[model samples]
Target: MPVFVKKVLAWGSLAFLIYFMAFRPEGAAQMFKAIGAALMMMAQGLGDFLTSLMT
Candidate 1:
């Protein structure tokens, strides 16, 4: 994409996301919780794999 178009999309998405999250605080909380869980699971899986590899 062109630089101008990329900038427009970045700003547009930021504005839309801010509006959506602000409109539904509960939804934002749930979304963050899900994201945190996913990160935790990924980290645990990675650690296990590395430990097994080292062993």
Candidate 2:
């Protein structure tokens, strides 16, 4: 189980690295900014769904 978790984390990090390097290499600053924006949107959508279920 530990080994599986480690492999999953490693693969996930590697995927992020490859995606940022290959597809978004205009600049590190901008790449991180886009990632943050995407995460915020994802979080907001998730929160909205959860709140709707409660209400």
Candidate 3:
């Protein structure tokens, strides 16, 4: 079903991320950390947006 497909895609994405982090970790480490920080910021922004919309 669609839910199974979504789970597969999510797991695939996670595997790719782990592979990238493991190999060529020098420059990639900083890049991945920066991306993780950006994602966290975006998540926080989304949460704030949703909270504001509710109130």
Candidate 4:
């Protein structure tokens, strides 16, 4: 809620990401791949639900 807290979180997250990417590029790639798979699955599930509602 506070601007200071938001800035801290943003910078902290950026730093962590930079560290992870620099130290473990393979792990970062796998993490992104897993996240993409999860998002795809969620989108497919939502589409199925909407189709079922229509029929």
- Which candidate tops TM-score? 4
lDDT of 2 by residue, 1-55 (tens): 6999999999999998888778778775687889999999999999999999999
lDDT per residue for candidate 4 within 1-55, as digits (tens), equals 9999999999999999999999999999999999999999999999999999999
The TM-scores, one per candidate, come to 0.82, 0.54, 0.53, 0.91
lDDT (Cα) of model 1: 0.94
Candidate 1 similarity to native, TM-score = 0.82
Cα lDDT tens digits for candidate 1, 1-55: 8999999999999998798798988988898899999999999999999999999
Of the two candidates 2 and 3, the one with more favorable TM-score, higher being better, is 2
Worst window of 10 by summed lDDT in candidate 1: 16-25
Total clashes for model 1: 0
User: Sort by TM-score, best first: what order?
Assistant: 4, 1, 2, 3
Give the total clashing residue pairs for model 2. 0
Better of 1 and 4 by TM-score: 4
How do the residues 1-55 of candidate 3 rate in per-residue lDDT, one tens digit apiece?
Answer: 6999999999999998888878868867889789999999999999999999999
Q: Please list the C-alpha lDDT of all candidates, in the order they appear.
A: 0.94, 0.90, 0.91, 0.99
Model 4: CA > 4 A from native: none
| Segments in model 2 whose C-alpha atoms lie over 4 Å from true places | 1-26
Question: Which is the better candidate, 3 or 4, if ranked by lDDT?
Answer: 4
> Against the correct fold, how does model 3 do in TM-score?
0.53
Best by lDDT: 4
RMSD in angstroms, all models? 1.2, 5.5, 4.8, 0.8
As a TM-score, model 2 comes out at 0.54
